[model samples]
Target: MYNFIENKNTDGVVFFTIPSFEKTKLVKHGFSSKIGGVSKGSYESLNLGFKTNDLKENVENNYKKITKALDLSIQNLVFSDQVHKDHIKIVTKKDCGKGIIKESDIKEIDALITNEKNVALTTVFADCVPIFLLDPVKKVIALAHAGWRGTALKIAKKTVEKMIQVYQTNPKDCLAAIGPSIGRCCYEVDEGVIKEFNKEFTNVDEFVFSKGNGKYMLDLWKANQSTLKEIGLLERNITISNICSMCNSEIFFSYRKDEGITGRMAAIIELE
Candidate 1:
């Protein structure tokens, strides 16, 4: 039920933005796609992941292009460590550029939250769900990288809870989006992952589909949406992109579809 508007800048950098967040005029946010960048071969273009085998120089250039296109300050952007954990970091001005322009001491953080203006928070993805959260009332924005591990740990809920505890954010006043990722149609997992999901979620069947032979297809969008609603986010306020990265590898990066040799897209947001 979530619709994302795609936009192409004059530089040919394609990104997606949520209409709900766009209408608020409280934040500047965008999700990067594979359609733009300087990287070549497997990376092709718009590969934002620094850890990938793509040349570090090309990755840096991609950041510059995307930050400019999204109107985000590359120098002020703080990125998540993204070890698939539920750890959340409260970002400040001093924390700017820790993960990009400078050395980062922000370790093991899968999510980032900030109420400071112009301090963009970013997290990378390749077939992993990117959860964007905005507390319009508090002028706070958060970006979470929820891979299967993070989703099983309820990282989305932890992010909202951290905002509540730190920024006095009310969940009902927040807007959330489950960004593009591998959908159930292509995300097949074994019992090991299913066990983790079962421990954290009660209504597992609603999002987990069986494919026989002990295989299951997990719907991270649904799981994250349910997590947000359980913590008081209104159903109408949460947007599920429903865009499958694996199914649309042309514009999006999918680790599964690319056989573990793909680039990464980024989900970024900042309070304006």
Candidate 2:
């Protein structure tokens, strides 16, 4: 029921989003594609991150492209520091432009939850998963960055818990999307990572696959789905993008595929 279909306009920019999400007039959210923007080389076109070697001017233009396409305000969007932890923060108008437009971003923030309107919550990703949460009933939304470590830390569920605590948002009233990232198809891991998953999840057999030689293929999408379901979100409401960033390197940036030199996409969510 969830598909992150491509959207290419005459301007040469591309983005991906669930059709259902697009239909929700109360919110505007999507994952940007590698196409569009004006960056060159590995950071060519549509690079949204400032930490890379890409020119700041190019990234700034990219942000303008996205915000213009989605009808969002660049200065109102917040960003994440992403330390692979479960840290979730409550956001407000005070955090406007903390990441992109503003020079200072709230450091060490992996996930952000907010009930305020027009304050778009954005999380950066190359191969890391982007989790979007929306409680339409309460008009609350959140965005999270989940790599292997954040997945093991159950950041998705933790974000939900924070919503319930801060906004009284019920999981039943929430719709979630697990955005594109490194899939199990290309995300092979060593014993060090496997041991971490085994310790956090008892049903490792479900998303964890044995590939022999002490190696494993971890399904971060399924891992996050399990985490959300365990927190009481309806199975139907949990939409998985199912797109592997590494596999679709032509359109999305893959840290592994690009050998760590690439652009980052922004998964943005906000109430209109």
* Candidate 1: 10-residue stretch with minimal lDDT: 1-10
lDDT of 1 at 86: 93
Whole-model Cα lDDT per candidate? Answer: 0.93, 0.89
TM-score of every model?
0.98, 0.97
Candidate 1 lDDT score at position 218: 91
lDDT of 1 by residue, 1-272 (tens): 43888899999999999999999999899999998799999998999999999999999999999999998779988988989899999999999998788999999999999999989999999999999999999889999999999999999999999999998999999999999999988989999999999898999999999999999999999999999999999999999888899998999989998899999999999888
TM-score between model 2 and native: 0.97
For model 2, the run of ten residues with the poorest summed lDDT: 1-10
lDDT per residue as tens, model 2, 1-272: 33877887678789887665666778988899889989999998899988899999999999999888887888888887888998988889888998676666588889999999988998889999999898888989899999999999899999999999888888998899999899999999989998898888998899989989999999999999999999999999988998999988888888999999999999998888
Model 1 ranges with Cα > 4 A deviation: none
Model 1 RMSD vs true structure: 0.9
